[model samples]
Target: MTEQGGTCAIPGDHHDTAACEHISRMLARISDKWTLLVVRTLGNGPRRFNALRREVGEISQKMLASTLRDLEENGFVSRTVTPVTPPQVEYALTPLGKEFLCPVRGLAEWVVANAERIDAARASYAERRAGE
Candidate 1:
């Protein structure tokens, strides 16, 4: 119930408005612009902070740091600081995080595969909204 997209005990044992609200917030965090990309990239392997920044496309430093910290807090990532050198640091997916990689990648693939149709749907919705 913490942050995973699962049922909630709030209100009742059965699905409730509180569960829906929890789901919405969880999606907001996981599907965040940087979080999604960061998880995808980290799925490949552990990476240094700068390496992650470069690989995740266009993410600001502060946003990336915050997202990584969030991911770490959510048990999706592990952060380690090497004692050697000028204090090297790296991040990798925990077992739990790895469990979600396939699903996230599949969602991304679905978007790519249906981009045209999805875009058309969005444009139609926008046009309908404008006319309303």
Candidate 2:
């Protein structure tokens, strides 16, 4: 009964923005530059906070903390604290986050596979610009 491509269950109705906020948040959480790197690093195994900082070079402490908190809230990662001396804390991916690995890894592999061509395209554009 609905018009073509209308999202609402009722006829001729539009999609509700508020209804989609959760998905919006989910997409935003994992799509940021630092988020992808952090998740990918955690996919390997649990690592101490310092190790994460080292692996993600150039990232500020505040950014790392915020990113981890978001991922933890979204159920993509787990944070554990140990009671031993110095009180250690570490992070690792949840199974949900682990599920994101193969597809993202494929994307990285595709970039590697096409890097030469992409570089050549950029170089060609630069040359053309310089010639003008």
Clashing pairs in 1: none
- Candidate 2 lDDT at 52 equals 97
TM-score of decoy 2: 0.75
Model 2: how far is 121 from its true place, Å?
2.2
Candidate 1 Cα outliers beyond 4 Å, as residue runs: 1-22, 125-132
- Clash counts for the predictions, in order: 0, 0
Please write out the lDDT profile of model 1 over residues 10-76, one tens digit for every residue: 6445546576776777878888778889999999999999999999988999999999999999899
Model 2, span 1-132: residue lDDT tens: 323333343444455544355455666777888888888888778989889999988899999999999888888889999999989999999898798766667777898999999999999999999999
lDDT accuracy of residue 46 in candidate 1: 99
Residue 128 miss distance in model 1 (angstroms):
4.9
